[model samples]
Target chain A: MAYSDKVLDHYNNPRNVGNLDKKDPNVGTGLVGAPECGDVMKLQIKVNPETGVIEDAKFKTFGCGSAIASSSLATEMLKGKTVDEALQIKNTLIVNELSLPPVKIHCSVLAEDAIKAAITDYKAKSATPATAQTA
Target chain B: MDNHHNCWHCGTPDAGSIFCRYCNSLQAPVPNYFEFFGMPLKLSVDLARLQKQFYSLSGLLHPDRYTRRSEQEKRYSLEASSILNDAYRVLRDPIQRAEYVLKEAGFDIGEQRSKDVPPELLEEVFELNMALDELRMGDDEVLPQLDESRKKFLDILVEMDAGLEQQFQKHDAQEGDEARRAVLAEIRLTLNRRRYIKNLVNEVDKLLTARNA
Candidate 1:
């Protein structure tokens, strides 16, 4: 099957791919996998803790070409958005943007799943109580 | 799929004779994987027998054998070689073989999202989910609880797996189709439970990984 030119371009020249300090307080990291292809993707966003804005975003994907493109595009969409805005990036939008085929749509879905997972991780960590006041 | 060919070793028909099964020349391609590997379709398969069959067949069908052949013949050889490898991969793994059998039998357990994970797995699934949730919450108390649950569930699965083997032996030896169908249903249920428990264990592993992550 002939892939989209954008997919081939991204596959040949992937951008902004790296890992974040996943344990850092200001980073929201999403890790996800696809059942059909057994692919893994990790997307991370460094958010401004006080303002809730994404200062930077990066991804590392291990799968077929479509998986790489989906993650690459996901990071592109996330950069510079507020953490809340980045979480709202939907799988459907990613799929349409990439014009992914039906069988390859899960690549985009995995990307979306990673974004949600990362944001949820950030929220849960933020909600944890810090040092308690002495009695 | 028509990978059948004439054996050049002695010009005997390749369809029915891999390595002649007569003169042992290592130059024939049997029909499907099971026949090629000389294995019966059974729940309790002998791994040793299966492995022996594969090496023997690979000796005949592997792509390296066609290096001196014409381009057309070499392409056919390569296709057959990959299929041979893929067949072994599908058959040797119990879970993969079971899924292939289920597909051939026209049954889909449904996608993972169909989370209508059978009611039988509810309690175990629920407990697994809770363990995952707690682990996500960074509760150090979760792994021990999951470890205990995993052990109990695995013990049950092992017992069931043994029972199915015995039942398979009996069913294969028995008479009527009615009796065989009944045994098959029982086997299916047992396999289904096994699948669910495996998914549960995977969930627990994911939880542990996330905690460390």
Candidate 2:
């Protein structure tokens, strides 16, 4: 299928395609997959503990162009936003930005799921410092 | 929903019939995978019996037998042969049969790129991908990690299969739509997880093969 120019742009030059220090106290990691298509996406965010603002974001995805573009755009939009603000970024918005087709809509959903998973992991870690290391 | 078919030659209504007895012509709208073979809607099918039926039907539907017959009979033979082939192709395998049944029941078995990632495997999946990337980059140090991932993924698959068997038994025993729907949902989730693990194993195997080569 022909991808939109925006999707092609992101696919060719994906922003923040890497990993964060998952073990860091301030970093939250989100890993997600679509078992049907075998698409695995890893999105991570580093937040400033004192300010509760996202300081950095990165992603690594093994899937299609839409998934790659979605995660790339996700990291780009996530940086500098608060965790709550990042949570508010909908899959619909990603679809709009990427001009994703109906079939590729699930890629955006995976991106959204990845973001939520990362934030949840971060919250869980912050809530229990004692067990964080063991966890 | 409509299973009835009329023979093109004689217009005889053939309900659950492979061929029209009136005109001896092939009919359209073949029965579903299960019904075509006169088998019960169950997960575990007897392969030997299914195979025997397939061969018997194949022999009966062989186009060679219709060589001296009318054009209509030859066409019917070809159609019936195609239907028989499709039924055997899907029903012979346990997973394919389960998926076919689910599809027939109006359940979407999320296609590839399905966004339904099993919640528990997120973290492990992330790390596994990282290990895969390292292996692709010719990093020998991650070999052990890849092996560990393979083992873990295989364990999940085994667990999923066991869960599927139990769900299948429950589905067969249940008498109501509500109970059967619940069982179907469980089977869907287990099948989804199994697919992911299978993909992961294939990924690991690819890397290992390249390394050995």
Candidate 3:
């Protein structure tokens, strides 16, 4: 199937394609996979603790073009958004933006899941004062 | 066994068998693969018996044999022959058979998300992909690491197949619906993980072949 031009564009020049420090307490890493297609996506967000805003986002995806584009676009959407605002990010918005076909909708869903997972990890880390105190 | 229907040719009440007993006319074939094969709804299939049945049924349902027969019989033969091929192909392979059972049991096999996969497995998959990416980028140093990962994944596949065998037996041994559904759930999860690792192995194999070539 032909990919939408937007998908192709993002795939060719994936935005924020890198990794954040997983050991950093402020960085939230979301590692997820779509087993049906054997796609793995890692999305991370570094939050500003005081303002609770996501300051930086990065993603590295290993899969088809649509999957890579989905996660790449997801990281772009994650930056500058607060933790709660990031939680409100929907897969449908990505689908519309990417013009993803029905079969590739799951790729967008994977991106959305990655965002939620990252936020959850960040919240979990921040909730534990022991790690913050030690650091 | 509950698929009792009247024979189209003889109007005889048939017990869902392939052919009518009284007038010996071909009935509409059972759609369910297990029922069509006259096998119980179980995962542990007997290959020898299944093969014998396949050959016998293939002969019986050949369209050539129904040419001189009624048009209805000929059509039934054609339909039965098609379903027979599909049934045999799917039931012969253990993995396909398990997948068929899962689909029949109302499980959504195709729509799995990342949450379904265990976190540790995803981490391994991610690292393997990173190594693969390095190899793709002209980094020959990671080739040895790729080889090691490939071997590790292959070993995991072998171990997983053994585990699947046990799950199959467990599923077959369960008589209650609740117990059977529980086993089916486990089988589904195992199949998903197996599919992921299988893809990883295939990817590594392809890259290795390309490098060698």
Candidate 4:
């Protein structure tokens, strides 16, 4: 299938593709996969403990153009937002931004799931006393 | 659909027999895979016997034998033969058989758009995919990394295969629907993991072949 220009661009030059220091107390990592397509995605967020704002975001996705584009846009939308605000990033918005076809909608959903997993990891780490509390 | 049978050709009724007694013609309409093979719906099948039955049935239903028969009988022969081939293909493999039974029992084991990646393998799979992407993009420098990931994924596949055998036996040994469903779920998860690993293997092979070319 022909990918839209937006999808091709994001896929070709995916934004913020890398790994975060998962062991760092301020960083949260989310790893997800779609068994059907045999695709895997990893999304990570670094949170500022003092302000509860996201400092940076990164993603690595192994799938089709749509999955890569979805996570690329996910990280781009994540930076600078508060943890709670980042959670509001919708899969539909990702779909719109990436111009993913209906068949690729699950890729967007996987992206959403990855971000939520990252936020959950952040919250779990924050609850631990070792991590600096993000009030 | 059970406890009653009628010969499509001669209208002679038979009680649950696959072939009509009066006309001695195959009469079941679209039999389930197990029923088509005249085997019990169980996981542990005797392959030699299955193969023997398959070949024998194929001989009887060969299109060559139907050329001189009535058109309606010929159609029935073709349909039965087609279903027979499909049934044997699915039943001969343990994994395929497990999946077929699950699907026949109304469970959607997996699909082309499935997104249920096992949680524990996410990190490893992510790294593997990165290597795959790099390889695909012509970064030959990452060949060592790709090779290492392939070995690791292959080990996982081996482990999953052993686990599948245990699950398959468990499925066949279980009696109750609840117990069987639990085993089937485990089988589905194992199959999904194997599918991912297989795709990884295919990707690695592609890169290796490209380099050689």
Candidate 5:
């Protein structure tokens, strides 16, 4: 099925494509995959913990247009939002924003999952010491 | 999903005929991956067998055999090639294959609470998580200490994998329904832990990459 204009637009020209300083406590990296499709998405956020505001957002996704668009739009929406606000970003919103087709709906869902995963990763990282060597 | 018939070129012998039995030209198979593998619809599977079958099929029906075929025949070959790749990818990985099989069985592991990662794995998972966290935040001093734990984890996975293989062989050998069902349940759990540990290793690899970066 062909993606809509919006989906194609965001997909062909994705935004916020990069990684955050995952090692930096303030950076949250969300890495998640849909085992069904083998689609992986990594969403990152730079948040101001004291204020809970997401300062910068980025993503790297390997999947369909819907998947890429969903993540791009999710990060776009995350700019300046608090952690709670960003967490509240739903799959439907991403789907609606990207105009994803029904069959590709999971792409949007994965984007949402990636966001949560990033937040979780961020929180986990921040909760620990400033520098711990993991191998 | 495939449909089989006699090989149009040479109808000598045919089962799930995807080629002319005599000519061996490209054709469509009657059986799908699930049927070809003789597997139930579940998220977990016997991967080694799946790999073996995949190679077996590739040896026979790969598009290269149809290099001299008509345009329509080549199109069929291209589609078949892609499907083979897709099926192999889906069935080879424990997680992808498991989810697909679950859907085929009309079940959702994510929707069900009973399958929420075996509780037995909880302690191990927690310890791994805690250690990963500490390692991620710990100083370079911790690097020297991680080797033992990494080796231990690998050894455990290897042991479990071998045990699972034995169970799988027994299940496959079973001639009756009851024996098969029991083995299936055992495989399901073993596969889950295998998936979990695989993820942990990936996470460790990521942390290592991040450190190097």
Candidate 6:
């Protein structure tokens, strides 16, 4: 199937494809997989404790081009957004931005799930008194 | 089994049998694979019996025999023969057979998300992918690690197959629909995990072959 230009562009030049220190109290890590296609994606965000904004985002995805592009675009979208604003991110946004086909729409869903998972992880960590005091 | 109909040729009432009792004409084929093979709806199928039935049906439904028959019989023969091939192909493989049963039981085989998978399995899959990426980038030092990973995955596949066999037997022996449904759910999860590891093994094999060549 022919990939949309946006998908191809992000795939060829994936944005923020790397890793963050999972041990850092400020870092929230999300590891997710699509069992249908055996695709695994790890998305991480570093939140600024004072401002409640995402200071940095990174991801590593192992799957098809669409999957890679979806996560790549997800990280780019995560940066600079407040925790609540990031929570508003939806799979449809990824689907629309990537022009994903019906079959590949799940890739966008996976990315969206990753974003939520990371935010949830970050929230859980920061909620703990020990981590909150350290931050 | 509720497929009773009148034979087109002889007007004989048939109870969904492959052939009409009165005129011995080939009737409309049964859509269900288990019924088509005259076997119980069970996951642990008898391969020997299935093969015997397959060979017999292959000749019985051969289109050549319908050349001189009526248009309806010919069409029935073609349809039955096609279904016969598909049933055999699916039932012969244990994995495909389980998937067929799961699908028939109203379980969605594909379209699963990461939440359904265990975290540990995902971690293993991720590390394997990382090793594969290194190997692809010409890191020959990772070859031994890759080989070990391949063996570990293969061993896991073997263990999973054995586990699936146990589940198959459990499914077949269950008395109630609820009990069988429980087994089916477990089978689906196992199949998903198997699929992931199977893909990893294939990737490792492909990369190793390329490096050797």
**How does chain A of every candidate compare to the true chain A by TM-score?**
0.91, 0.96, 0.96, 0.95, 0.91, 0.95
Which residue pairs in candidate 6 collide? none
* Per-residue lDDT of model 2, residues B88-109, tens digit only: 9999877888888889888988
Candidate number achieving the greatest DockQ relative to the actual structure:
3
Q: Residue A86 error for model 1, in Å?
A: 39
| Fnat of each candidate | 0.00, 0.87, 0.95, 0.79, 0.00, 0.79
Q: What C-alpha lDDT values do all the predictions have?
A: 0.69, 0.84, 0.92, 0.83, 0.69, 0.91
* Evaluation by DockQ, superior candidate among 3 and 4: 3
The digit string of per-residue lDDT tens for model 5 on A1-135 reads: 878898888888899987777777899887665544445577899999799899999987756678888888888999999988888988998777777778788888888877887788788877777756353
DockQ of 6: 0.67
lDDT by residue for model 5 over B1-213, one digit each (tens)? 333455555565553445564565666543355754545544446678788888887766567877787876777777776777778888887556645544454444443111334434443444454466567786665565455556666887898778876865676677776666666666666665666666666766788788889
Candidate 2, CAPRI quality class derived from DockQ: medium
Per-residue lDDT, model 6, residue A35, is 79
Kindly list the per-residue Cα lDDT of model 1 for residues B1-213, writing each as its tens digit: 333555555555543434444444454344366654666655456778788877876777777887886565566566667767877888887656655555544555444321223434444554555566576777878878888887877787788677766866765676775665566555555566666666556666676676678
Which ranking of candidates, highest DockQ first?
Answer: 3, 6, 2, 4, 5, 1
Which lDDT tens digits does candidate 6 get at residues B80-175? 999999999999899999999999899999857678778877878888889889878878788788788889989999999999999999999999
Error of 6 at A135 (Å): 19
Which window of ten consecutive residues has the lowest lDDT sum in model 1 chain A? A126-135
Cα lDDT tens digits, model 1, A1-135, are 989988888888887888789767778777665433445577788888889888888887767899899889888898888877886889899888888999888788888888887788778767664332121
After superposition, which runs of candidate 1 have C-alpha atoms over 4 Å from their true positions?
Answer: A1-135, B1-31, B70-73, B109-121, B174-182
Interface RMSD of each: 7.9, 2.8, 1.0, 2.7, 7.7, 1.2
Off by over 4 Å in 6: A127-135, B176-179
Best of the two (1, 6) by TM-score: 6
**Which of the two candidates, 2 or 4, achieves a greater DockQ against the reference?**
2
Q: By the lDDT metric, which is better: model 2 or model 6? A: 6
Question: Candidate 3, which segments miss by more than 4 Å at Cα?
Answer: A129-135
* 10 residues in a row with least lDDT, candidate 2 chain A: A126-135
**DockQ of candidate 2 compared with the true complex:** 0.62
Candidate 2 Cα outliers beyond 4 Å, as residue runs = A1-9, A129-135, B1-16, B19-29, B111-115
